[model samples]
Target: MPIYNKLVRDRIPEVIEKTGKKFHATVLSQDVYIEELKKKSFEELEEYIAAETGAEALEELADMFEILHAFAAVHGSTIQGVEKIRKEKEQKRGGFNERIFLVDVED
Candidate 1:
């Protein structure tokens, strides 16, 4: 049996069982669940970076968004609240539409 210590989607065990193979898994505590979700966010971001096709990239991006929603819920907030914060930051600092790259700032 292969070892997998990473977090997985909710239906992973069910999917594995459907393959006629037995797998072991544990339910994480609330604290551990939040930590795992944070890790999963990074994993999904890397996947989005490596995606080649538009559809694949969009899928990965969606996965990251889902994780974000989970994080928001864990923190007693909603996705809409998160988006409001983001919009506020964008309004104040601006978004990436400029694509400006700052190499150095010395005076």
Candidate 2:
């Protein structure tokens, strides 16, 4: 009977029930959901950072991408819209393909 006070995938409750273990769960409000999504995004990012292999990192990266899509949808936008915005930023500021690391700035 472990207590989990964090958010989980939508099917998690159903999976838990299949094991004949009683669980307490409730739907979150839109505001709460967004807040939790933000936290979940960071959790996933940390997981990606701690991943030991390329495949593991890619899996965590996919989780982060899913969270991003959900975040955009919650904010009354779509993943396509978010991609458009990202592209615009990349066009203006340039992408990280250069792998440039800034060390210092002098006046």
> How accurate locally, in lDDT, is each candidate?
0.94, 0.94
RMSD from true fold, candidate 2: 1.0
Which regions in candidate 1 have their CA more than 4 angstroms from the true location?
Answer: none
64, model 2: CA deviation in Å?
A: 0.5
Report the number of backbone clashes for model 1.
Answer: 0
TM-scores, each model vs. reference: 0.89, 0.94
Q: Write the per-residue lDDT of candidate 1 for residues 3-81, one digit (tens) a residue.
A: 9898998899999999999988999999999999989999999999999999999999999988988999999999999
lDDT of 2: 0.94
Look at candidate 1 and give me any clashing residue pairs. none
Off by over 4 Å in 2: none
Top lDDT model: 1
- Kindly give the number of clashing pairs for every candidate: 0, 0
